[model samples]
Target: MNAVDSALCEAFAPSGVLRVSINFGNPVLATRGTNGEPQGISVDLATELARRMDLPLRFVTFDAAGKSVAAVAAGDADFGFFAFDPVRGKEIAFTRPYLLIEGSYLVRSESHIQTNDDVDRSGVRLAVGTGSAYDLFLTRELKHAEIVRGSTSPEVVNTFLRDGLDVAAGVTQQLLADAKRLGGLRLLRGNFMVIRQAMGVAKSRGDEVATWLDCFVSEMVRTGVLRRAVARHQIGAMSAPEVKP
Candidate 1:
């Protein structure tokens, strides 16, 4: 990897430290360590980026993606991993995705919601993490279903069960774990969406910072940095295919 240009460092770490936002809500990218610290692919990527930039590293942790995105957009953090969403793009500039995570729906075993499309019917209340990629996407796409907001992705199933919602939507891995843990729940047959998870800095960081980040991610994909991170973490997500910059 090339030495990070001084200007690039200035742009990414304006406070003289690289503050990376880690969202533990997405189990496929991050999880709480035994010591209560953040760990997993997101942390590994953030650490690697800071090391390459030679900046002092700091973590701004959140339990939900919305809070993580807010921290980056509000300049409380320098960069964060996020699912690509046009709604969030208004405040963030993202690289090409480094990972693809499936989004699916979970339903009670006796529920009539047997397919992803069945989730869109009127009177069927669906629970989703507020401001999640799927939340933003389904809000726009689902014409009839009433969307209930879960406090966090990991809690969506709990919210669904608590309120007796017809469907619970979130990362497939998370839903699968929830299904196995709670019993009598099963995920729909197919994914409703593929979340393109990528690293992003606030749009206020300027195009130069965005370009550098994009190039860095493309290199990570090409050189297997992302693949190794996924393998090391043993997460369910797949590394995104390399894309020409």
Candidate 2:
């Protein structure tokens, strides 16, 4: 093992605390609270992992999921929790999924756009975070809807909030949370795509950690810890766990 891995092993050998990195952009995953401390589903899950492992926890935040995954690959973080994708799989090892989520279009409640069908019409523009999975998904699925890409979710949301686009397509979890807070935005009842969320570790790190994480995630799902966390956070877009094959 390398120095970082050796150090991590030594660190965990005594206390079992693992240093994990997660994206703060997705409120359902990790985000700063009013007190400026980290909070959210991934944060809770990380804490739970630490508890189950009889270890303390360390957290590192990134602006996006891609960044978080990159951190894992660079050994800057031990692991990451984010949506799993085939493209990302080539770069990192991923645990079996703990949760499923879908993407949806968010629109102002007063806007006439009410469905995916509505978004297919010409002249309708959908805002998305540039270079994000949502952007790629929207590009593939919505041939007729013009895409307006922003660098961040807040930028995309703000553009849509200001009427710059007819809709904003994002993860349903975030859309629902934004709807609750902003009042004017609403998540359409239907989904555009389904995504599985998993923990990612560096590809170079061998499968030991990934195997452990996968087993832990399976137990969390079976014991209702995953469900409780989602419900407690009111993450409306998350789907119930699927039985592992």
Candidate 3:
């Protein structure tokens, strides 16, 4: 077995507790329900990781992606389950990507903006959650679009739904799930760019932990567990990295 597998054997050895941090913003990661309990792909993955490690799982919620990164940096969380960005990487160490993702534009189904060219028009405003990876990507890539930044994804979505903006940019998975609920919004045909999703651990923690997480992630992908989990959550339709090539 690999070092990560060995670490798992030790970490879960009937007496360890692995505290992982998760964000509720990303459905593929963690999110809270109306009842205020944790739910979503991140929760599922954390639970599974705990099961494999035979350890207990604890969750802490944050309102922003930056705060989630802070939690890991402050040692309040052993690791974080969220999109890993290079900017945030400076604050914390990241595991090898366990999954891949693509950014997308979300707009009302009835909206006239249907293609990439449409989004570039002067009047088309793009809403995004402040400090989100999507916001970062949009600021960097969609230079021509006016950005209407919100503090949360729901706020951003609601603003767009109310016609406060012409379009909103977000993770393709979130847009897809929300589209089912709103019934009037649609994800654009293509993605802005692809990103890798990995776990973030405190930099103070030795690289051993990050190395183990990377191995665990690699194992999950190789064994098809990661793909299975994505399908189980009905998020398989979202774009993921082309298998290591």
Q: Estimate TM-scores for all models.
A: 0.98, 0.81, 0.81
Worst 10 residues of 3 by lDDT: 6-15
Using TM-score as the measure, which candidate wins? Answer: 1
lDDT of 2 by residue, 1-245 (tens): 11234444543333355778978766666678898888878888888776666556888887776677777778787777878776678877877777777878888888898777888788998888765567766677777778987556646677787766788887776777678887877777788887778877777766666666677778778888888888887766454465673
Count of clashing residue pairs in every prediction: 0, 0, 3
Residue 64, candidate 1: Cα error in Å is 0.7
Best by lDDT: 1
In order, candidate lDDTs are: 0.91, 0.73, 0.72
Off by over 4 Å in 1: none
lDDT-superior candidate, 1 or 3: 1
The pairs that clash in candidate 2 are none
Give the lDDT of residue 228 in candidate 3: 77
lDDT of 1 by residue, 94-173 (tens): 99999999999999999987888788998999999998998999999999999999569999999999998899999999
- What TM-score does prediction 3 earn? 0.81
* Candidate 3 C-alpha error for residue 30, in Å: 3.0
